[model samples]
Target: MMTFYNKQTTEQKEFYENLLSSLASLSKLFSSSDTPYLHYRAHEILFCYAFGANNISRGDVSFDATKDGVGIGLKTFLHGNGNTFQKIAEFNSVSDEIRELGSNHNDIAHFIADKRNERLTDTLSITSTKEMLYHVITRNNQSLNIAECRMSFVEKARIKKVTLKKNNIYFKDSLHEYNFSLAKNTLYKKFDISENILHSIDVNIMGNPFQLLENLSVFDTKESTKTMEIILPLYSTSTGDVGRSSGLNQWNASGRERHQDEVYIPIPSWIHNQFPDFFNYKGKTTPSFMVKLPNTDLVPFKVCQSGGKALMSNPNRLLGHWLLRDVLKLQAGQLATRQLLRQKDIDSVLVTKVEGKEYDYELDFLKYGSYEKFEESHKE
Candidate 1:
């Protein structure tokens, strides 16, 4: 087993130990029994805080936090002898496809394996993380165990056998065992504790957490403000796919032969109609602003084309190079199809308005149906 403490300083180890104990003690307020439970979200936040990592949980990608170019997927579950199968992915959106495959174990196994691999690829591309690992926290009533293992893609070629029982399908690659549930449309992977455990911590549950809270005289109740954001779909809404002659395939748009990197994000007319003041523009002049990319580089952006229907980076190719070449890994002159977007589990980019600026925004990728969810949340 790897020693996580060996890589940490004495001070860091002390802080981590204290943090876990405090969390355990505080968890008593919500539990009916004396046993303290660590919530998964709390584990993610505190893990990042203790390790000086950037919390990327909001992105809803495979990983929850990143540090030193490593993307970490945080998992916390009840520890039962340090070995258990925990959920790793969900395919509820494609549940119909899995159901249609029925009892074809090989086909179902291959299909889900491909989907899992696609998400891993998408996570790495979007986060620009050099490596990925699962940082799991397994907890019993009195203690928590930390384990680390490589976050691997399901080896499609190495899928040796697939078995089906009831609504669950089981399969294994050379490195890991996987289970897929048709009932829940979720994927689970076996985490072998004996092979990966790095640290073990004992937490003391407070007998009376209510008394501790009652001793505090003041509490902060103010809620943090939500960022104003908009979702712009990668595919054209009119066609439900990348337009052959426009959108991401704009290189094929007629006139003169265009550069392969001449793509632009399409902005629907309804977006401007609903949020008229979102983009800055005068009567005749085009609107120009700055967009901060995931890599922290700010590039000049402009709304162009008739009725301001396109959002393109100034010098135009910059945005395309990042979106098409870097993130999507599209080849030159290759069209960005809807299938390709779905494979990446991302169909849109969320543009959040930067504070203190009317036009400047930050861009992050979003999963499919995010735009629909965003709109539903804003319904009158």
Candidate 2:
């Protein structure tokens, strides 16, 4: 087992201290006063922290003329050269690579659509960042490392043109609009123009420019061919009074109206590709992630310690564990959480409405003999 050490070489010490300082700096930026430039402020600050600590490697934390600079292009930054920052994606208690972006070893480059939607902008707030830091820093050998996470939101866009410029595919949503009706808008979207998270557009870390695609799929064009897939029936009004209805006479009876601003998640195809298991043979089986439906459950410190990115990534995985531990009251060392699927249950959920911008989500579950029953059924 690796024990904590108080001593280290000058370079090692610099790397460690740089991260410590970066954390402090980021914390201050997040907790400080609000501003229209909050997005820009946090973005640059995160870049500063990531770039500074990234250079601490190879004995070069001091800003030099070479790879040690954080101001490198986005293309270069993704290439992982002078600096490293944690990429955020929902994950389990352990670390997993959801996707790969340009490594910063080269030049840094990033891209923003002339009209990128903004529903998941508030992700910059410390609520999500804190979880990311806890796992990326505190969990792994307690050492600071490079990482990042995917942000999400809703966007209602009309097809303009499918253009492929600069190796980045951009499906521009002309006149893109977002809903800031309730405070919920603050939960995810935050493009204050007055406050933007984007540090610089067309940022590439190593010449690996961000690929801009016109649509989710090249085949999905202005004429459109694909159908909207509901990953999880958003938790909206119930299926009764304002629930999802089904009837012939009520053909239009599906009264539920999607926010004119369709929900959109900004995870790149690379990162989005990580959750294949969630969709694999999906129509056949749905992952019934277990949640400890305590009337007023806390954010279980164990789960929070893993960080929100981790919490979001494999929600089903951790939810399974919570069932085994909290609900089943399993012993600490007895066993790890078991992955289970609720074929019927998941199928039913397919029609449920999701509660957008939930602090914590609630889902249907089996009351008694659930974990054991699932375990025994899969014994084969």
lDDT of each: 0.80, 0.24
Q: Give per-residue CA lDDT, model 2, range 122-232, as digits (tens).
A: 111201121111111211111222222222322233433434333322232333222211111111121222121212222112121123222335453454232211122
**All candidates: CA RMSD (Å):** 3.8, 22.8
Name model 2 segments beyond 4 Å from true: 1-154, 164-169, 174-296, 299-378
Show pairs that collide, candidate 1.
Answer: none
Cα-based lDDT at residue 136, candidate 2: 19
* Cα error of candidate 2 at position 153, Å: 3.1
lDDT of 1 by residue, 112-212 (tens): 99989888887787677878888878877787777887689899999977998897899999999999988898999998877677778888888788898
For candidate 2, the per-residue lDDT at 20 reads: 47
lDDT of 1: 0.80
Q: What lDDT score is found at residue 97 in candidate 2? A: 15
TM-score of each candidate structure, all chains considered together: 0.82, 0.19
lDDT score, candidate 1, position 197 = 76
Please give the distance, in angstroms, between residue 52's alpha carbon in candidate 2 and its true position after superposition.
23
